[model samples]
Target: MPPEFVLPNYVLRVFTLFEQFSDRLALVRGERKSTYGELIADVLRIAAGLRDAGIRPGGKVLIMAANCFDAPALQLALHLHGCRALWSAPITSRREIDQFASLADADAFVYDQTTELGRELAQSLAPMTVRTMAELFTDGSPYEISATPVPDSVLQTSGTTGDPKLVHHTQAFYEQILELAGAFVANGFPLLRHYSSSPLWLASGQITSFFNLFTGGVLFLTDTWSPEEFYRVVSTERITSTYVTPPMLYELLDHPSGEDVDCSSLFMLNVGAGPATPARLRQGIARFGPVLRIVYGLSEAVVVTAQPGLTEDSAHPERLASAGTAYGDVRLEIRDDDGKVLEPGQTGEVWVQSNLTFAGYLGKPELTAETLVDGWLRTRDLGYLDADGYLFLVDRVHDMIVTTRRNWAIFCRPIEDVLASHPAVRTAAVIGVPDPVVGEAVHAFVVTRSPVPEADLQQLVTNTLNEMWTPAAIDFVPELPLTRIAKVDKVALRNLYRELHPDQTGHDDAASRAGEAR
Candidate 1:
């Protein structure tokens, strides 16, 4: 790690790159391209427009838009003016938009006119000052603003439930992020041309986009994700690096266009947001070469661990299955429920102490207190560290299903992994549903190329593990509902299960009936 060099203000650090990379192409959206000089000018103009519209420094502004040329500029303007920019997902429901708008007490709502939802939000929030991107960049007026003590930004969570929590990031956190980027660049991290398909609201996309621009790389922004389009962008633009969630990576690997796409120019393909099954990881390696970097992170703790290169030797082949070691100044520990730190190879809840962690959940002081303790953030993820210091995630602590038969705790990832290993299975999700017979029954929802009998899948898990760990019911679905960031919507599946069996009656051959409608 490089010597700690912290900036009092985050935007000041960003501005330092302006003079050097001014003429370089900074962003590319479809056919549109903008150089750093032009982008900085537009950012200032937008800031002036926002100021004229009654947005003041030290206030919060909600920005809702898809990937576009204006989105980054607006975010930069917010930071440069010392306003807390809150990024709301474009797919957010009207109710969520209203809730978040009210919860954040935003001074103004800035949106892009490209999407219907963005336009609708602009109209509905008319009572508050709502300005479209087109309206914000009307003047190239230079503006001068200084940073304040307020946080730099807020990231909204993509909770499966109707409610999403807000995580705050202070200016210190932003400084640390830029410092890490500088350190990585000094260590020969590639930054030339990058592609980002994730929505701006997601931390995964937001972080990557920031670093790419800060390092003077051209970022290819896309509103929608298609494996074919991603590959086409990579080959045509010679994209050197990109970030893909596990689900998106699966799509890229399975897409027919992937077979012939020229990916030689790609140097780094980061896999993050969720764990990638060993089978899928290997398959990705086969398709994208060994450039796959496994990243483990969450909304609260930006990035906990990342395995950049998969050079696992025979001595520690299991390192391929690990989430890699700690990142930067992050400290990792596995602790039992009683707050006892467990030794290596002991499975427990993961705790992290890091500057990368968010300040805290917005407005939920009690909840934040419960999570952040003594400068350590409770990750709530169940994992164990091996003797070689590789971290292996088992599952979310709350996601563990406890069977009534023997009061045994069953982690869903292992069962899901076994099902995914099946030849016909394309993607598999294992969720626990409430049952009268068992404390919680394991249910599997699978998307496959061809139909396979539920009994066969049950036997596969049974043979792999024991019968108790096998799914109580299996449902074949054409597709799984994804959250805004593309992770499996387990909450939706749980609700669907309840909706199907409202009475919680007997299974009544649920396997066959599960696919009937839902």
Candidate 2:
């Protein structure tokens, strides 16, 4: 290990807590239960192993693994060894993984050998130093702890828009998490027995794992996710907190066994990664009591805003659609195209400044510069805050559907929300498709519990907004395709639309058409 590289004080403090809670359960994966003492031992052993393998401080180590018993320990060990850990999800395509490996320019690769992808990656990235979980956990001399060079991490974006970018986070990000964890405990929040399938590659997973462990709480890591399995775990293990996307929440609400599930122990069920329809939010409140917490954040800045214990307020029933107030020390602003701050009730791009903000996009200085302007991170999400400071998201900036109808611009969230309000509609996603008449026409994909005519759904949008905002075509589907992170895959939806209508070639003329209409 490099002489200057040492573990941060915050990390040492967390490890001290682990020792204090030595015999207490720290991690659960499948039938495996690891106590805090065991976790600390594993971390130290892994650190010593890294040193023995000649992996020194500041070395960029690429990691590909599913959520497992050893993941948390491995991550902590890497940090303790003062290595820059680059995390990649096994759920993504091999091609993407290869690209990520190339982009990271890592000196070594650490993988879980149990997975086929891990084995494959290990074989493919030959000649490079590769270590498995078992090899790292082998009995070895515990690594000495000191205090100098801070460790960092590289996380993969959710890839909801397109190709995933590597998000760089310095030691400061982890320090913020420790502070947040302290605040969470001090504020009288429940000690989280967090159950999540989100992998370490994601920012959400990083925060969830670190926050739970920092507070000396049990983290239940899983690779597979289903409503039934979720209910079973919650009922059996008495899970207090968990994270899910809107789609997963809907599935839970729609599941037949949900009513009978013993979910009273659940204190906080975090719903995030995408917007949840008000109708489904109401259903969740009715079914799970006041445990639903609507969270809104990006990989660049996690936990930007959160609505805890969501309920249908009689005075502000529309707040159900809101993403809640700014969280922690975040400074939020709604800025128009001119970069001027907009007053409450004006829809604009959301920008935030906070300690939790990422360092930058690894190797993409241009993108980093574009996203992080001055001190604020432009979220690229179109939303507005009300008088009471609740944020109501409209859509992504790129997701705005340009129409020739009076040269109007339309957002998908409002249309999707309208469609979701229908009794027959279960959930809906709207995207822009190539159209000669309207430049970029609104196309909706809907999942329904019962059959409903396309005309009725179109009329719902028209009645809710106007005829101009109605979807050009509505496709009834069993379920919307989701990205690896479970966000509605709008890119896949656009491709599906193109596949269905082979005649529509390109939206090459969309910009000209839109301008001519103006």
Candidate 3:
């Protein structure tokens, strides 16, 4: 299937949202709450400021801030006023921040001195003209902003590679993608509200925030991940729906009284930073109830597959091991090495076709040609569909490791499940290496429990796999490197493993392995 060019009509306009839904709670930012009316007022002022600052329509405004109420509000303001908001996550390393910031041609950058690196970024953006929320409010272009054609959506690689092309997503399609999600959430509740802990530079959570804002929903603020704090929000804020990574889900499940936390008010929860184990899904279902939704899509296409109502029985059935079915308006195909579509239950590279997909790479036409062929976006992930239309993920084609014996994801489902179930292992990734005997042997990387015992943990895997699917080696790690999107950065893991062990992997900390016994 080739890409199609049918533009979706915009239903929810910014002006009407401001007028009809005024004086309602629009954003909750700790001690500072902003009503829709107040939010609109600020946005209008900011728009006026951008215009006053000589920022014409299509001029870029880079947002490098934390998860505050002002962040989403600023983005909406820019969209309303016909400017592209290049939303960057609160980057830490100066090298990373400068590297990405240098890539964009912008009128202004928005950030404050709240963080050490952030302050430095603010200084760096001074030459490029950075504007804080306070400055935007004082600008005098106060007439209501008019909508324009879609602006550019830039996609940055998660530093898995040194340089990544900016994926070109127009504002029109990006907003529509969010609108679809918000519409799905609003079918039951009076208003759709979403909360995100990760910063906006990460695409999924950024959309979750905007989905709540533009489509008749409130946006709440949480700058970073904290299980205990999230527990408070579920009860105090009466939060309805949330999107978080699997690691954060694990953190929430481990909070003191984490199991007993009252989250009955929640309508749905989206978790997609990475793959999950059956036990992790079961634990989430038990903890968050049936409202949990597992999303399995790379940043390249936003989302193509999802298993809402993430339950032990449905998405993670004992025998199925599937990532669920296609989203609305999205079609999926699993293709083999030669790009031939595979049959049901056959594994191959997964490609997707959908109205909700992105346009192309911003400046890279060759890369765009390679990715957006005809209309299909060739996702490098390997997966298969069952007879029932349920999709099962295999692994990345690039990340796939082939030893003499077999080809495995290295961090695919089986190993993720087995290790997640390990009492001492909180998170793990499996990699394959050259083996003289078995052709290829499995090496497991684990984020073990505190004071884990190396020998006991090794024995656990030996007991679990028992020669049927045993790893060539087992290594214990303090933590796995996570992508900015929050998924396990397997690329980084492979490199780090190569460095630390050089020839072989390390064992788990013997004392830390004791927690699994709990």
Point to the candidate with the largest TM-score: 2
Q: lDDT by residue for model 3 over 247-271, one digit each (tens)? A: 7787787777877777888888887
TM-score-sorted candidate list, best first = 2, 1, 3
Cα-lDDT of candidate 2: 0.87
Ranking according to lDDT, highest score first: 2, 1, 3
- Cα TM-score per model: 0.91, 0.95, 0.86
The candidate maximizing lDDT is 2
Clashes found in each candidate (C-alpha, N, C closer than 3 A):
0, 0, 21
Local error of candidate 1 at residue 85 (angstroms):
0.9
Q: Where does candidate 2 stray beyond 4 Å?
A: 1-9, 158-162, 505-518
lDDT of 1 by residue, 1-518 (tens): 12232224567668777657898889898889999988888888888887888887767888888888788888888877768888887787878877777778788888888878888878877788888888987664468665454446787784545776888877767677787878877888677688887666777777788878877788888887788888888888999888888889899988987979899988888888887787788788888887888899888888899898655457876677789999888899999999899999999999998888888888889989999998999998999998867899988887877677887888888888889989899889887776657756888989997878999999999998999999988888888887767888777777676676667634443522332222
RMSD of each: 4.5, 2.8, 6.1
Question: Candidate 2 residues 255-338, lDDT tens each?
Answer: 998999899999999999999999999999999999999999998998899999999999998999999999988889999998
Model 1 misplacement above 4 A: 1-8, 138-141, 145-151, 311-313, 451-453, 499-518
